[model samples]
Target chain A: MRAEEPRLDAAGALAFKDHLREAVRDAPPRVVLDLGAVDFLDSSGLGAVVAARKFVANGALELAALTPAVARVFRLTRMDSVFTIYPDVPQAIAG
Target chain B: MPRERVRFRADLHAVRDALIQLERGAVLGPLTGESRSVILLVLAEVMNNIAEHAYRGEGGEGSVCLWRKDGAVMARIVDRGLPAPAIPAATDTPNPADLPEGGFGMPLIRVLVRELAQSRRCGCNVMQLCVDDDNAA
Candidate 1:
């Protein structure tokens, strides 16, 4: 259960995408993305989450725990229905 | 009925503060949770676009001018950075699945705001966003 909130920027989006790919490389994975401290999220930021979900699905892993703003983005884009979203880290891990 | 202009850095935190102030000052009538959320989302998207693509993370300042006229809340953002690309014509419905996070900023702005305009003026990019007060109904 590894988590990180790398500094978000235009260029940081690429790094974040790579991080997601790396995180899901191992099998039987459990990952939590903490977005509570993230006050800002751009399209690139949102895309990284989507890409991560795709990676997790490939390995039969679960991805959850989206903060309010991030959850709102997923909802607006209808990705919320696609991803299993939880309010906090514990709930995400437990579920 | 005079317009008010605020200049601040193009950072995300600063833009969030500006959106909060905008809601406090401009939003009249009942402040429903949904309304507040939508306004914040719209403003944040626009500001992020200016900070990321327009300013290219160079830490420049941009101006947001707000004015109420004809029962509408109007905001104009002027930035001395890259010019905005021409917006394609609006389709009937948005395709969320195909939406790329990187390119959705301007499109999201257009969807959330009642009226949106973009142009390049004197080597600066000027974007106008408006929300109709009636939409709250």
Candidate 2:
């Protein structure tokens, strides 16, 4: 799933999560979220991404193509260790 | 010293606009790209908290003022909203195995900033954050 929004901050975190939940209602066991276009992410946005994983049911939720700003948030929170991050969507799907 | 200030309503969308205005203005323009990203991250956490917690009910207005202090970027965020809850001690990120979602905000603010201070002035909540490029990730 691609995040069309340039920013995934507090302004749209909830909506993003809700949208993800709706999109994944009948998803496969593995889901990969494409974050290449999201330039900014705060803790609220980070939480929304983490929360998106929970929406996947028994399957796993992965991430791809973190921008510099978004990468910094994950690194600072050490959330980089938590989520499976990929250089791009294809790489994420390949793994 | 060059200074810039961005003001916005308490809503979350306005918070994003304020960050963009501050990022594009002259104050952060002189900094390195990495330094600016660090500043933006710290300020985004701070402003979003105010929008979500301090002004949750009735909503209000807020402003972020930026200036240089001894080679560090200083940001003063002032909002006419409710007083903030007590700050938690600066702690390491929780065990990721827990799949934590909500507790990363304060810890990110505590880790990325060189200095953090908050107070209630008159009827507003005032937060000060210092972003030192040398120390920030």
Candidate 3:
């Protein structure tokens, strides 16, 4: 469970994306992105999630646990259906 | 027509809180479920842009106003900061593939609102957004 609060901009988006990649690099087959602390997100943040989904799709890794605001972005773009969303870290990992 | 106005420093969190207040105050009353979600998304994106880009995160001041006239919920965001770039000509549909994390703000703002107008007046960038509940029906 790697958590990051990068500056709220493109740099922050890229940092989160890199964190997602690093978390799944060892092929753990399961990952949970904890966005509870993320107060703001934009389209770039949405793209990072999409990128993470593509990265995890290659293996048995699972990505879940999107915060409400983060989940809202996925839902707004209709990408929530594409990614399995859980409410929290424990739930995501348990599933 | 009297309008409700709220002013705050250019803080991302403050902008979001103000939006939540407006949403709860019946500005988007007729919109429920998915429709409400659309309004929230658009509002957050635009407010975030103003805080991040327009004000450059330097803590400038801005005002948000919401007015209900007829069946439409109208909102105007005015910021005393750098002027935003002109609204792009092609705004109806945003290309998800070519979207940059930062540049997608204006495009998303355009699609989320029923109507959008942007201009620079008195050294302030004013963004006008409107949503008609009747259209959602």
Candidate 4:
């Protein structure tokens, strides 16, 4: 699922979490979140992404297409090492 | 550029809007993309800290004043809410293998800004952040 919004900050973190929960209810074996269009991601958003991983208990939560700003959050927090990051959705899905 | 100020409510939504306004303003508008992102990230962390911790997730009024001079962008955020924790010189990076859900804000702020100072004055929390021109570092 791609994040349509330009920003995934504190204001949108909770809603994003809720949406992710709903999206994976059927428990797919893997979920790849495409964040190509997301220009910004604050710590709250990063936290939401981390929390979303827990919801996919039976599956994996992978991230794709991190824009520079979003990538910065993941890198600085060392979350880049935590999530399976891919250059794009196709690569993430290919894995 | 001259100092620019934005008054906003201490809520996530308002904070986001305030950032948009500031980013488009004179102080930040002409910065390199890398520099702009650094300034925005640091300010967002500081403001969100005020909204989430100081305001206890409740809404309150606050202001962000910004100035770009001396080869740096300086920001001062003021809010009338509970005081925040001390601004540590360094913060530990949470182990990602633990899948920690939170605690990235302070460390992000610490790494992105050139200088940070937090203090409470007359029942208000004031946070000052300085991002150098060569923020690409």
Q: Name the top DockQ candidate.
A: 2
Clashing pairs in 2: none
Residue-wise lDDT of candidate 2 within B1-137, one digit each (tens)? 89988888888888888888888888898888788888888888788888888988357899999999998999999998888975665677777778888888778878888787888999989888889867647
Fnat of candidate 1: 0.29
Candidate 3 steric clashes = 1
C-alpha DockQ of every model:
0.26, 0.78, 0.22, 0.76
Candidate 2 error regions (>4 Å)? B86-89
Better of 3 and 4 by DockQ: 4
Q: Model 1, B6-124: lDDT tens per residue?
A: 78688766765666566566452244444455555666666777787688777788888877767666778888878867655562323545534445555555566787788888998
Per-residue lDDT over B96-129 for candidate 3, one digit per residue giving the tens place of the 0 to 100 score: 4443233555666665567788989999999888
How does chain A of every candidate compare to the true chain A by TM-score? 0.73, 0.95, 0.75, 0.94
**Candidate 3, superposed: residue stretches over 4 Å from native:** A1-27, A30-44, A51-95, B1-3, B29-31, B92-102, B134-137
What's the residue-level lDDT of B81 in candidate 4? Answer: 90
Q: Write the per-residue lDDT of candidate 4 for residues B1-137, one digit (tens) a residue.
A: 58899998888999999999988998899888778988998889888888888899888988999998799999999999987889789898789998887899888888888888888899998888899978763
Clashes of each: 1, 0, 1, 0
**Candidate 1 off by > 4 Å:** A1-28, A32-42, A54-69, A86-94, B1-4, B11-33, B68-72, B91-101, B132-137
Name the better of 1 and 4 by DockQ. 4
**Chain A TM-score of prediction number 2:** 0.95
Global lDDT of model 2: 0.86
For every model shown, what is its TM-score relative to the native structure?
Answer: 0.65, 0.92, 0.65, 0.95
Ranking, lDDT, top scorer first: 4, 2, 3, 1
